[model samples]
Target: MAYYKEQFVFDDGKPIPIIIRNYMASDLEGMIELQAKCFPPPFPTDLWWNEKQLQNHVSLFPEGAICVEVEGEIVGSMTGLQVQFDPKNPMHTWEEITDNGYIWNHDPNGNTLYVVDICTSPLYRKLKLGQQMMQAMYQTVVALKLERLVGGGRMPGYHRFADEMTVEQYVQAVVKGDIHDPVVTFLLRCGRMPLALIENYLEDEESHNYALLMEWKNPFHR
Candidate 1:
């Protein structure tokens, strides 16, 4: 069943139907293609979701594994899992938390929703698909009555300023609007607040192996 649906009318003046729904076994191929298109050359193709991992996502946490579809094609996707979060110790590598993208450690009783990955197709970037996917996740958070939605956002734009400023400074700059980081800025626009800066979160050279811990608290949670 579809979790959410909307129609987007772009410059062409044609309404395009967009659906946010749970992942199905049939979506594996399209998802693999999306990963390649979203993260090209230097992104380590091995990091892409394999058939096994995608299968596990649907089997273990179908509610958390969703995709944005348009005319039967998967244009965007987001994957998440519930985890017992420790605010006191917010430092952890992505692999350690996401189980190297398999999300095999998902805890049904956990209090927080940890976003494993969220990406949009290059062709649909301007359609605000990412934001819509985030909104869908927000709905899931409220429905699940979780404490918050948390994730490590990569600083793909950091490589340019690595020689001039520390990761801390760069994050502050982005928060203050003094600098523009694609990932960090997008998270901020999505209503997420920066929790901390994590080191060795991932092996992305563009991000200098660093990631920004971000969160969006559930307003309805009591």
Candidate 2:
């Protein structure tokens, strides 16, 4: 596939161009190193996707596994799979959906694009690479004729008030504009609707192991 490109101007007025494209066999090492830099401590090592798991993602959904490159170096990645949107069972934990990134649940004929993970290298965070990756996913969703984008967004800021509020209360607060969560806020800005609060979805102490079940409907889906 051809690389998708976008240009962004920083505070210094210099234009930085980024290329989004499908993951390649040669990008395996860069992807692993970038993944390591994306998560902080207390984020469980066991929950992280290994090379084999990433390989599985690529093998299963080549069109959904995307990488971001700047100046010839891999700086961000977004991985997703196609799955049927079952209205009967709307709520699902991260593990149940992605099978911990082994992607055993992928359905090539499905109408929903279930994004499993989106991360940017630490050095590139200021460049808003994560947001760029999401935009790329949006384009992919439109191209694939998907109906929606579904994923669990980490609530890294929730632990600050964990002693005072349950995950539900916290999510409720965020939904009501009583509080702002970095991840949740960003997802909202990206046009995703927060559907539910998932418990023990990830292994981060800071997030209190909570994640927001977020979905963005594809307007182009017909």
lDDT of each: 0.91, 0.81
Residues 28-127, candidate 1: write the lDDT tens digits. Answer: 9999999999999977898789999999998888889989998888999999999999877999999999999899999999999999999999989988
For model 2, which pairs clash?
Answer: none
Residue-wise C-alpha lDDT for candidate 2, range 7-98, written one tens digit per residue:
76363577787778888767888887776788766666665668888888778888888888888888889999999876556777777888
Top model by TM-score, which number?
1
Q: What is the Cα-based lDDT of residue 132 in candidate 2?
A: 76
Candidate number of the best lDDT: 1
Candidate 2: residue 123 Cα off by (Å): 1.2
Single out the weakest 10-residue window by summed lDDT for candidate 2.
2-11
RMSD of each: 1.6, 2.2
